[model samples]
Each structure stands twice: as structure tokens, then as C-alpha cells.
Target: MRAKKIYWWLVFSLSALPSLYFGLIYFLNPRQLGIDPVEVLLAESGQWAFRFLLITLLCSPLRRLKLRFLSRYRRMLGLFSFYYASLHAVIYVVAWIELDWPIFIQDLVSRPFIYVGMFAWLVLLVLAATSPKAVVRALKKRWVILHRLIYVAALAVMVHLWMQTRGAIGEVLLYGCVLFLLLAERLYRAVPLLNHQSVGKSANN
Candidate 1:
């Protein structure tokens, strides 16, 4: 039991380190961020948010490969994704828009990427809110359906990134491929014939 507690502590600490480093750099050495510090922060935090979200999606595939221990860390990874996403939103509001409601509203209307990104963030907010044991227990079967929105969130994020890219689409394409594979795996498992074949192979192994 103590070991389990230690494991979670380690997971949380490691997950928090990047945000801490980013925060320190942003606050202590704004010069290091170059002329477009706000843009830099927005990009970095937004990238990490998507990265963590992908990692959260990967937990299921890893578990299927017998790395069941990863399940314990999944919630932390998801929550960290939400944390970075919230930071990304905050930086946009404060640094980019300077808390100007009129500008924010205009951007929401004019920028489809911002609208999509905000929708993804809202989904993450809902997932994070219901991640607790009590909430999951209360929701029961409905929880599974609700959490499936993660895939929608992932799709929205991909669109958001694609729309935001100014030039090279290499990174966007890479993430798109990864998300594709993850979704494919889920679909593979959902099909009974394929799932049975996979189970047979696993048992034979």
C-alpha cells in the first residue's frame, strides 16, 4: 500500500516538473522567451497539453500489451493534460488578449481554431471534473460513454493545431497519424472477430 502511494507521488511529481520549469522561465527570465514570449508560452503549453492527452489515450493500448501498471497513472496524465490546457487558455486571455473581452469575443467569432480549441478544453474540463472515484462510481456505465468524448476532444485538437500552423505541417501530420493509430486500435478491439483473434494470439503466447 505504501508502495502504491509512493508510485502515485512519483507520477504526479514528474508530471508537474515541466509546468514548473515553464512557469519559472516565464516569470524569472522573460528575455529568454525572445520577442514573442506569449506566443512561445501558448505554443509550448498547448503542445504539452496535446502530448499528455495522447499519452492518456495510449494507456489503454499499453494495458492491452500487459502493462497494467500504467492504469494507475492514467488519471494523473489526463489531469495534467487539463492543467496545461487551462494554462494555455489563461495565457491566451491574459497575455494575448490582455483580458479584453471585446477582442476575445471577436477572436472567438473570427478564429475557428480558437473556437475548436476552446471546445476541446471544455471537454477536458468535464472529464477532469468527473475523474474522481466518487463521481465515476456514481456515473457507472454512463461514465464510459461520457469519457468517450476524449476521442472527439482529440479530433478537435488536431483540427485546432492544423488550423493554427503557419507553415510546416510535419508536426501536425505526426500527431494526426498517432491519433489515427490509437483510434484504429480502439476500433480493432471493438470488433468481436478481431478481438477474439487478438485474445487467441495472446493466450497462445
Candidate 2:
């Protein structure tokens, strides 16, 4: 149990390193952020958010491959994803727009990618809120259905990234391919169970 606790702290700290590093650099070494610190923060935070989200999604496939212990960290990874995602949104609102609600609403209307990104963040928010043991118990089977929205969030983030960064086309494609494979694997795994259910229903009928 001590070992498990230590491992959890290790993962929690490692997951937070990116944000910590970014925070330190932004305050202490602002020169490193180039002439556009706000833009740099926005880009870095947003990228890390999407990366963590992808890592969270990977837990399932890794568990299916026999690294069953990885399943235990999925919630941690998912919350970290939400952490970075919130950081991204905060930087955009607080730094980029300087807490200007009118400009934020303008962006929401004019920048369609912001809409996609916000949708993804909202999904993450709900998933994070319902991640606790108590909430999971309250949700019961519906928890599974609701949590499946992670795929939708993933796809939306892909679209958000693609729409926002034309220069990073290669990175976009790489993440897209990874998301596609993860989604495809999910479908592949579901097929046999679905077929079995169908057969059982037919037999019953």
C-alpha cells in the first residue's frame, strides 16, 4: 500500500511537470517565450491538454494488451487532461484577451475553432465532475455511456487543433491518425460483444 501510494504520487507529479515548467518559465524567463508570450502560453497549454487527453484514451488499449494495472490511472490521466485544458482556456481568457468578456464572446462567434475547443473542454469538465467514486455510484451504468463522450471530445480537439494551426499540419495528421486507430480499436473490440448479444436475443426470441 505504501508502494502504491508512492507510485501514485510519482505519476501525479510527473503529469504536472509540464504545467510547472511552463509556469516557471513564463514568470522567470519571459524572454524565452519570444515576442508573444500570450500566444506561446496558449499554444503550449493547448497542446499539452490534447496530449494528456490522448494519453488518457490510450489507457484502455494498454489495459486490453495485458497491462491491466494501467486501468487504475485512467481517472488520474483524464483529470490531468482536464487540468491542462482548463489552463489553456484560462490563458486564452486571462492572458490573451485580458479578461475581456466582449472579446471572448466575439471569438466564440467569429472563431469557429473556439467553439469546437470549448465543446471539447465542456465534455472534459463533465467527465471530470463525474469521476469521483460517489458520483460513479450515483451514475451507475449511465457513467459508462456518458464517459464514452471522451471520443467525441477527442475528435473535437482534433478539429480544434486542425482549424487553429495551419502551420502544424504534420502534427495534426499524426494526432489524427492516432485518434483514428484508438477509435477503430474501440469499435473492433465492441463488435464481438455486440454480435454475441444479438445472437442471444435471437435465441431468446
**Residue 36 C-alpha lDDT in model 2:** 86
TM-score of 1: 0.91
Per-residue alpha-carbon lDDT of candidate 2 for residues 1-205, written as tens digits (9 for 90 to 100) = 9999998998899999999998999999887988887788899899899988888888878877888665678899999999999999998888888999998999889888999999999999999999999998898777877898898999999999999776658998898898898889877867876767553322100
What lDDT score goes with residue 102 in model 1?
A: 96
| Angstrom error at residue 105, model 2 | 1.1
* Candidate 1 residue spans exceeding 4 A from truth: 193-205
Clash totals, every prediction = 0, 0
Q: 18-73, model 1: which lDDT tens digit per residue?
A: 88987898899977987887888989999999999999999888888999786768
After superposition, the stretches of candidate 2 with alpha carbons farther than 4 Å from their true spots are 197-205
lDDT of each: 0.88, 0.87
The residue pairs in collision within model 2 are none
The TM-scores of all predictions, comma-separated, are 0.91, 0.93
> What RMSD does model 2 have?
3.9
